[model samples]
Target: MAGKRSGSPDPKRHLWVLGLIAPMSALLPSQLVLYTKLEVFWWIGPIIVLIVIPVLDWVVGEDGTNPRDEDYELLSKDRYYRWCTYMFLPVQLSGLIIAAYMWSGDALSVVDKLGLAATLGFVSGIGINAAHELGHRVEHLERWLSKIALAQSAYGHFFVEHNKGHHARVATPEDPASARMGESLWEFLPRSVIGGFRSAIHIERERLKRKGHRWFSVHNHILQAWAMTAVLFGALLAIYGLRILPYLVLQAVIGAALLETVNYVEHYGLLRRRRPNGGWARCSPRDSWNSDRLVTNIFLFHLQRHSDHHANPGRRYQTLRTSEEAPQLPAGYATMIVLALFPPLWRIIMDPRLLEHYAGDVSQANIQPRKRERILAAYEYRAAA
Candidate 1:
């Protein structure tokens, strides 16, 4: 069923190397601070993610070009693409280790240390994106690497919850990661974190039960994943002393918050309709909100091609296509992340978009249960009008 790519060879084949920017951005600040003796450079990681990338996205604009269907096989098989992500692990670990050293030392003031922690948090958050790409792969090494990447944020459960839980129930009321119509980022974050954690445990426990494995057995994937985090954090604490604990915790919280913020953006208010048999409809390209801005595509490894991803969950990052049916985001994830922090601003921008996506049907969206009456009152009139 694959069609040949009629155009010249993939234009972006070599450009995939630029994916290194996310991991390298963390280390760039350290080198700048080293040479210039300015602590301000410690803030570069967040600045690059929050400011520079969004600016680049605006300037460079969206790239709707998809790798031709015929090329998906060749492109996904390329070892070079695999290495681009594999190389991220070293740079990411290096950034965290370097941050631990700096956080433990007395040379930097509290403000400077906090800035560095924020930088590392963004790095860790972006590392989660790397883990996401890797975690979805069927390869054992890549799956293990996914857990290692998640170790930085102490969010090892995501490896299970995402591939198992989210991809199953996305765009539905049952999915905690799927933000409802009226849910703000603040309200959604805690629900997602706690709910996802519980879901991961439940998933793992069910798997273990089927295999006749005890709850405490080595076969527990969640325990195996969390063990890596324990060893990673323990090693850092052992080397850096206790002074770095607060910053360690701070960066982890920031990293987790960043990941959850992106989750809130991915499927905000989208819903899968129930079928005649009371089953949910299959997730289609239209279920996930997608963006294809070139910069964020490279940075997040085509994660914004999300609708295709949910549709073809096994597809590699480089080969994920933009879908015509997917509801498009006004801006890339970086810009949207900042907007999501403010509830009113988020509703002002996304509420109408959500309504519009469902053809002005307020009943079609996955709305927050507590706010459903108010949301209907607010938007149903507009829908009818």
Candidate 2:
């Protein structure tokens, strides 16, 4: 097997890490099932995730770097990608089954409630994050898995908008999800959620127009996404009554927050240049986040290999790699995302490097290809004004 070869040390490491993430993910929801009360456990989930994980990561985190050359080729292949898609199925289905059990049990203690919340949250992660990677795959089955994962998270339209719009505009001012240089996470979340949905609707509408289909047709992804959310809501109401509505909302909110936190970290200080013709530059590996942390990368199904994802959108997640020239995060994505939440600290650490890269100026020289020209044009227009 590719993972067992002499030159495949890091791939072996990645497999080990993947093994760890799979079980941890499986266990998280089960742990939540032990919580006694839903309300208390709800807060505990964020505390453990946001506070506890970050502290532990900071203290014991491995340094990030490019994977070994031999491992890179082995890791960046279709088989691994397919494996990632396959793994998500069990995690999602398991979480769903456990959630159904918890809902059926009714009025659990704090520990049991916590277990349920954690399980749902982890399941949401598996569905959304794993699907986010799979959705980019060129293979039909992998693509279908991606959509199923998104539906599980109740964010089905993300599969459409993310591929069509987000990739095209990422790190540019036009991207609502791209965090501006000094923007806080608090400021970015609402804007991104609202703007991203709007952009998705617009993209879908244009796509439908091209296909001679009406915007309101059942084929529209946005409408379909809304319908899915409604169906989930109705199911909850039917199964657990009105009391469970708040928990469902909480789950969705946590899932959305996790997605946005990742967005904030991935392109925190990256920018594209404008072309002479006023177009943005095409994305390169350097335009997105890169990390080679064996643990988190595996846990995230190689999502830390983001530069590859942006460079080759159709590549499967398991096949993502650390590009030679892509800017790398200092550690895993989870650690960076935590750092991003504290803007002052983030700026203190990152601004100097960014300013050095731009030589204290924000000109065409610092931007790339077509993006450079557009940026220059914008500058010139401003000067004229």
Residue runs of model 2 more than 4 Å from their true location after superposition: 1-4, 7-10, 13-80, 103-115, 225-233, 362-385
Per-residue lDDT of candidate 1, residues 1-385 (tens digit): 2324433345676777887877776677768888999878888878888899999999999999988776777788878889989999999999889889988999888998899899989989989999999999989999999999999899999999999999999999999999999999999999999999999999989989999999899988788888998999999999999999999998888999999999999999999978999999999999999998989988888999999999999998888899889999999999999899889999999999988999998889998988888888886443333
TM-scores for all candidates?
0.95, 0.79
Score residue 340 of candidate 2 by CA lDDT: 77
Which candidate ranks first by lDDT, i.e. highest? Answer: 1
Error of 2 at 242 (Å): 3.0
Residue 39 of model 1 has an lDDT of 78
- What does candidate 2's lDDT look like per residue over 1-385, in tens digits? 6555554544434453353343245345445435653344434445545555556555655434445556655566637446745776675656555565565565575455555655466457545787787777677787767766665557777877788889999878778777665566787788788888888888998999999999889777667656766775677678667655555665666677788778877876578867899898788886776777665655676777888788877655544567766766766777777777787888676655555545555441323333445544644522213
